[model samples]
Target: MRGSPPCGTAVGCMLLLLLLDALLLFAGQAAGEGIITNHVVVRLHESAHDDAHQLAVEHGFQSVRKLPFGEGPLPLLPPMSPRREANAVPRKRQRLQKDSRVMSVLEQPGFSRQKRGYRDLNEMEVNISDPLFNKQWYLVNTGQADGTPGLDLNVAEAWGLGYTGRGVTIAIMDDGIDYLHPDLASNYNADASYDFSSNDPYPFPRYTDDWFNSHGTRCAGEVSAAANNNICGVGVAYNSKVAGIRMLDQPFMTDIIEASSISHMPQVIDIYSASWGPTDDGRTVDGPRELTLQAMADGVNKGRGGKGSIYVWASGDGGSYDDCNCDGYASSMWTISINSAINDGRTALYDESCSSTLASTFSNGRKRNPEAGVATTDLYGNCTLRHSGTSAAAPEAAGVFALALEANPDLTWRDMQHLSVLTSKRNQLHDEVHQWRRNGVGLEFNHLFGYGVLDAGGMVKMSHEWKTVPERFHCVAGSIQDNHKIQSGGRLVLTIDTDACQGKDNFVRYLEHVQAVVTVNASRRGDLNINMTSPMGTKSILLSRRPRDDDAKVGFDKWPFMTTHTWGEDPRGTWVMEVGFQGPEAQRGVLKEWTLMLHGTQSAPYIDQVVRDYQSKLAMSKKEELEEELDEAVERSLKSLLSKNN
Candidate 1:
């Protein structure tokens, strides 16, 4: 109304009001029209319309909103938005971890399997810690009370040179171990535990827990148990601290690898322990997932107690048919020193089954291997059980690292790896190993057994005495198991409690469309998986991750996976461990008995750590001696007083 009274102005105002009313009328037309019989498509200002009405073409906005923009969701089909549960995923086909439940795709068909009897035929009863002796004499002459052909004199040299694990920190990435197990209690740090498997903030298992495989427990015992108290046996390293990290559960390799790389619930606990790889032709160049490699690098860079971490890996249990070119995981790299089982010689004359000797055999292509052996450890509730494979060897090496770290304090994982390599001497050490073994069917560093055997004492002293790591021949064997190593390959014999193989009852039924929950301990790394050597009719299939679906990444708040199986090959019952891979593109491997190994590793240190704490031989109370002296003094005073008074 420019001038307030123009006739044109009044007419224009009326026209504008009319236009607004028309728009509103159009927007609500559907409400009264029963429905559009001819569906008209109109262009309108998005902001001006309620999924309807149209405005002038000059409006500065986008097109109209879709019909029913603000209407309540249609009554039936799942509400506009739906909620979901969480779960986990796999990373490979053959990497197995602690507690996991899923088989790998590699377990498909006709894949080559690695299996063989483990016999440390050349394993010897040797102790290479003598103060007096030509270090080299151990190779040709018998050792000090240890029946070996020669001594790993280098052990003494290292001791003389002054090297003990002082600044090193080893992370025991395996199953949940009994931090308080008498056999492995002392060496554990007061605060060291985390269940990467279940995402439980506290890694401790139940108070009265039984070991799944004992592989971890045995390994721990060998690594460090307070030495000298004499409750059980001595550890390779006399004084060293060890830690544990559980990250598996008979699940899938994908589950294991993801757990290892946890960043939320988020588990990110890192520890160096025995794990990784399968006896798959001994290919040291296994194509692991990216996260596993990153995790390893991170561990070394972020060591325990600030010194850095040392990870010890067991090469594999597939001896007889191993090919150096395909050595599986952890052992696949130079950073990881592969371990082979040796007859450290500390064994009962008979095994739990009352068998004269403990061993397992296998058929590798055209040969029959019978030289199987068992690693040593404190007796689990059940006497001595046969533990087979390189699975046992990795823990042995880890134990020595614990001892060395207890002394030196600055040795890094690299240092430990270097020491291992510098000591191996192909042929020269083969003879020494034979001497240590009393000469059984000992082969050089063939694909079957990696680089022969491990020497705890020899490794302990190497840091100071030797300038470079040994290559195939460790100097001294420190104190070792003395028992034979376990090698498998006969028929797949699955034993649980005391139940024999039940074709129709237990395992047979489980193999039919099974859904297992595998829990993996944080011990081994790289891609995880399992290769079930069973019938073909049945197969394992990955279902949607469930119950808890938070994140989709490898490691997160929600990544537990569930798999369903149909029919598989005809074999034994459930395997002691599952077979799988870390991911869709990973290699197959045997699940690591991280929990059993954790406890076993602690056994030796538990006994030895206590022993080293003492200085006197009797192990009696020093306080008791002082109390006796006081009594005698009192008696003398009374006699003197009586004489004076008389």
Candidate 2:
């Protein structure tokens, strides 16, 4: 009914009307949301540069900035009052759409970023009154003390989620604790504490001139120092209860003391943290005595109302020259051996490397800086930042375990180990001497770092929904009685092919731990190195060369060198063992006996699900790669077409 106004042809008039309609629609949508910004994006024809300035001025817009892409979208600001800006977009769009120099016009939409509903340790709101809390870099590392940022235990997120290790008790089995200290007084569990050294109920530390008896107190503070009391740094599990067993203050450590200390209050105590072990001199090979071994077996079998009491042992501070497997406590199946990592996520100089270490925590390391040491409560109601060594690492792990216990108290000792293997993070941890390797089922592990650093937040969250693992069983896979000789520079290799005791009551389907008991003697004990390869192709260095050991006469006697490297792997087929020497000169050795022991569950449905999930992830990864390649190919094709047309 209406005649064409400016354009002569009806098609041209229709195109103009359609463009104005599209621009009006865009402006309407922006105004409907009340998102009236001062700037607008525009696109101009290649030949319109000279007239762009004049055209922009006529539409109440001034050119401001050019986007990154060449001849791409340009930003223009409307020289108008904010009150008038709301109605300016539609008018400017109409005028710009009708101009010959302009190709298109669009109103800029308002956008704002927001924090995600889920939070990590770094993002959570934590209010603590302790003055030294910020200096505890291992708990909440924010690039303080010249350390790497975000390399911490991730405990804040767990605390925000209301898991503070409440209703759980961690016993410090060391010298003794200063329970009277303000920071530790409120959380001390006296009913479960005893001084085996004095054979009395008061487990207070025996004071001396040197204050050397502060080990137990410092370790206790790492686990359960009271929070918000304006004292020292807050503990990892600040709401948990701490008990001190004063046994290491004696003149000599006896089997009875060791047994009684390990078995004390097993029903009430959720975790027993032992920071002391054998001499760790790289020469001595010692372990729990007969009575202590019996007590440990009882603790795991009947402790915690049959859920099993958690025993956390420090992997020795024997340096690279010593292997922690020699300290039988760290390598035992009943204990969780924790190693140490520095503030920079590197292995500490004094950290002992072994296959038995389940996980790691922070320690003072070899750094000479005073702030680099672990900050905790000291003796005589004081505070210190000089606590160091694997002793500092074990208590941190015990605290993390306590957090998991508070989240789910039904977790067993073995369940805790499983959680450690599953939830621990490899976060920037590196070892120059040993490389990280994946196990048969793709679990990453290092001889020094074990599975990885303990992750408190991940462990606590997973523990909330964790189901108990299947009943554990043991199988004597194979036994080799024939004696073999090892030449100076050569190696002794033995192979045992078996079905892992199939069709028996003690059959093992999925492996948890493997022990290779060997009776061998060498001319130079320090040069002996032993390795075992599982049927699934995972090779575990059961025993590494300890350079400081000069004991040539008493070479290992029926020593059960254990390894957790074969965890979650199938135990079928043939297993291989290699024994050799590494030294300046060739050393002779003899292999008297070799016995393979397998411990695991007969059926683990969760492991099966894990394998399936891993496969699905692999498939999804491959699909994503293919899609990315196709996208790149299409982009290249489109660019080529545009170039040809130009």
Candidate 3:
């Protein structure tokens, strides 16, 4: 036996030993196998091909996904993640140079809003006098007497002919609107509007009835009241019961919640007007955002009216082949309609000497958008703004949709897409592959201009009488939730919002089935698994999951995929997955390590591994300033305390 160690020595030794053990444990756990997200390259076929399983989210399976048919084109780039904002354009970004996984995510084709030339809207023509906006069936041109669609003149004529668009429900889905605005009162279908943006915050909190720049108000004015009886311009569907959807982020941006919330609503809004889509490339593609979009499409397929429902999606503002789909709200294989632009390529000639072109009547500076002139409603609500782009185009089309629905509320979303294409006088039967490519190319019903400028009169005539789907397939997602709490054994229904305004860009989820995996290792890589069991049991699909690390995070490299499903059901079943050990792996002796993951995640984000990289840069600036401030305060306090002590 040895002499008893000194009390102090023993205590110190014990503490050192404990610290060593803790270090070892931390190292071991950190080196343990982990899970993460993975975005796989995918190319899905459109519904016209009937190969629905190719896409993770399809409209047929979503009862609320109001996507239209004939998805003309997709956007180029996805909108900025709701979690990120361009505080400052960095000179250099940490891009995924050669990493295919990361590069694929970074290089995913999407429209570029930063590029020039795409914003030549000030030079285009609204073609208000074009044949498309005409309505030979309704009446003659404002003065030409050949039957055209005009504002005040045609509206007055229509009223005289008993066409006030009364009894029609026009749903405008956008940022919250001021229900108390004088112009919106009589028409503000508050009972029809709902806010998915605010829970603790009230809708239109400040009564900031943002007049001149309010996107919702401007859009509403175009659709209904530009300034009823106020010598202002007339509305497309004047006298129409314009009910705002009251759901949207500011323009050119969106959040998952906003994207997902479009489907879960209380009232049955017949004609849903969406002047929004994904900020991704202009091509009309679908991904994780399919839930909200698909749900909206489901709403369409199911329809509010006995006849059916129709959802109108705005093509997008970056008109050229850029991200035309604003919020994933483009026409998919459902009862939805997409609106595009058709510019006569003309602009209002403004004399320079009187360049009264003020940004805001209050800004007193050179305006933000100097390029002026288009179909958009402008000053005093009488003239259209010089604004051009798919943003304005989509609303223009939505306005036309309201009119058609007013004429015949029985039109379904499918009728809107298919019929519009088949009957479009501009591109009646012309078909070309000139979608969202950067060629400024077009051919009849090109992707850039779905069915070539929504010809309202044509759609009205075509949809007079349509049929129910031969074997109409319907599906639904659910109420979009970030902190989703899906009950055990219960299904996670998704709300599909494929419109461009709704940013449902890529499908997202944690490892498909890796339940709170408390332990994992490299050897048992395949053991800890997850899967997306499409509601339809249609598993001809691929899955992607990231390989996690000891930190409970997965690196993009160790992505996972699933063997396509065998196939079954129409509206898809639950995506159930289980975790199990294969060949006795994942058993790293309980040294107290946890290889866990979120309970129910179906998405695999490759770019998430490197996101908001600029956040650190911004934080550094703030952190330094804070440190300096703290140092100064400490100095002052110390001086005061020392003097008192002395």
Candidate 4:
């Protein structure tokens, strides 16, 4: 008689309906709506919802649901609703009385942003096995003629130390990674992977037909492909977790989209390995937008349980036609800029020289024969025999970081940098560019290779008992408006004595990075070269002649050129900048304005502590060795006496 007897009984039907309602409510609260997903969130005074609902309804916003924990209402507006976009809120809300129940409204941000040829699976796996592993000279060089026997990443020893990066997570901010690849599947972390291009969760490359879409998968394999699985050679951190962030798949990348991708899942993702950046062309100069900058800062300040997320960036691959300083992301003080060394342990031709570079790692180079490139996992469950570029180098360093993290899980972003400076092996390959000189603190540095090649064993050993650096100290000097005209065959040298480097809460002795913000106008930008010399006599080539950069009228405009070459150097002495023109013709340039920002800390205490620790350990080790020797000598004497008495 009433709705087919209402589930055969009135009371039973009512109870069933109530249970379903409760389940639905629970589900809604659990899967909370996105902040700006066609909804406006508004918190109302207790018991004032009735009036708020009336007002919302009057404005055509349907009070769809209440927020969890009694936070507020998530009201969905129709497509035709006025002020649909969060950025365009109604002006009348401000004029409304204090009792209007509107606390705050902000625009919820959103984000939007390959493979080898075919082959049989078994054959490919066999072909990709460790038979070629020995050919990976970057892992353990056995005197490869052109390379020193141990001029490698020292990863094998780290592996022997039982650190395969078991608990670290490195997010590859690249095109896409093939999660289904046999070599990478075991270590891939799906929870940390995302595709900003399709607004989906999986980050599989859009195209898998050829090697073009295989970049991310290759990079993933380098970071954390499965180990000894008979699938591929192995990754640097073969037991670590790798996740892909597919933001570069889109043709164009906006700042908001990049912000979302870089800062995605900061609480979970540990290290972000970014190989791509703004146009590497010499003429182009670009960097992160405001949102993306904030995102990077947030990542370091909040990620990895507050130890801070590690960011490894490729310095740039525009060496032939551009300088790495032209690329903003690499030159930014926030990143650990990585440049490429060849398998022969020499600087690669395509590797840009920049003061911002932190360290170097082996990669493919044209200078060597048989052209060795990094081998790792590929598309379609296969493996690739070659993957090269600063792209390849960055992931390798990221893998080393993963190993370091696994060895010592509490390393902050700055701690990693400090360890890098302390343990990296300076290349002594007899190359002119790779020559090293002492900084203010007597630490050797080379602009072509930064501190030097990464040493996984040394880094991991240091990480095991490393102490974090002191809080960062900052000092700024100048807007020295030097509108001096620079003509051909002339040079301008500017000097500033850093007296502001000492004060309460503002003291900095050792340096991490120094940024020179220069403004210049030139008739030919490519004809200009600039360098800075610290009081320690460390020279940083801030700008080099870029033959391809021909823009005449506009030079660096308040451009921030950063250098890490002066690391550990005392920041209290006179700093000099030399700008000169290289062109033979009478071309003119104007040095408009420039500023210097130094970032460091009172590192004397930290350095002293480290030295003391090292000395104590060394003494203990020597005493132990002497005791062992003494015991052996005593045993020999006893045995000789026994023999003579017998």
Best by TM-score: 2
lDDT: the better of candidates 3 and 4: 4
TM-score of 4: 0.75
Cα lDDT listed for each candidate? 0.34, 0.86, 0.36, 0.77
How would you encode candidate 2's per-residue C-alpha lDDT over 1-646 as one tens digit per residue?
Answer: 3764787776557545655555555545544664567667777887876666677677766554667775554646455445365666777778878988778787776666656422343454888769888888888887666677777788887898998989999999999999999999999999999999999989999889999899999999999988899999999999999998999997899999999999999999999999999998888899999999999999999999999989999999999889999998999999999999998888888999999998999998355777988999999899999988999999999999999999999999999999899988888788989999999899999989999999999898878767788999999899997778888768888999979888999999999989999998888888899999999999999888888888779888888899998899999999999999988887887889899999999998357554345436656765566556545655665566568769
- Top-lDDT candidate index: 2
Where is model 3 more than 4 Å wrong at Cα? 1-162, 200-202, 205-213, 226-228, 249-256, 259-261, 264-267, 280-294, 305-308, 319-327, 335-339, 342-387, 427-444, 465-469, 473-646
TM-score for each of the candidates: 0.39, 0.81, 0.41, 0.75
Clashes of each: 203, 0, 138, 6
Better of 1 and 4 by TM-score: 4
Model 1, global lDDT: 0.34
Name the lDDT value of residue 250 in candidate 1: 42
Ranking by lDDT: 2, 4, 3, 1
lDDT of 4 by residue, 111-152 (tens): 332232222233322222554465566776665424555567
- Better candidate number, 1 or 3, judged by lDDT: 3
Give every collision pair in model 4: 113-197, 114-213, 114-214, 115-210, 115-211, 115-214
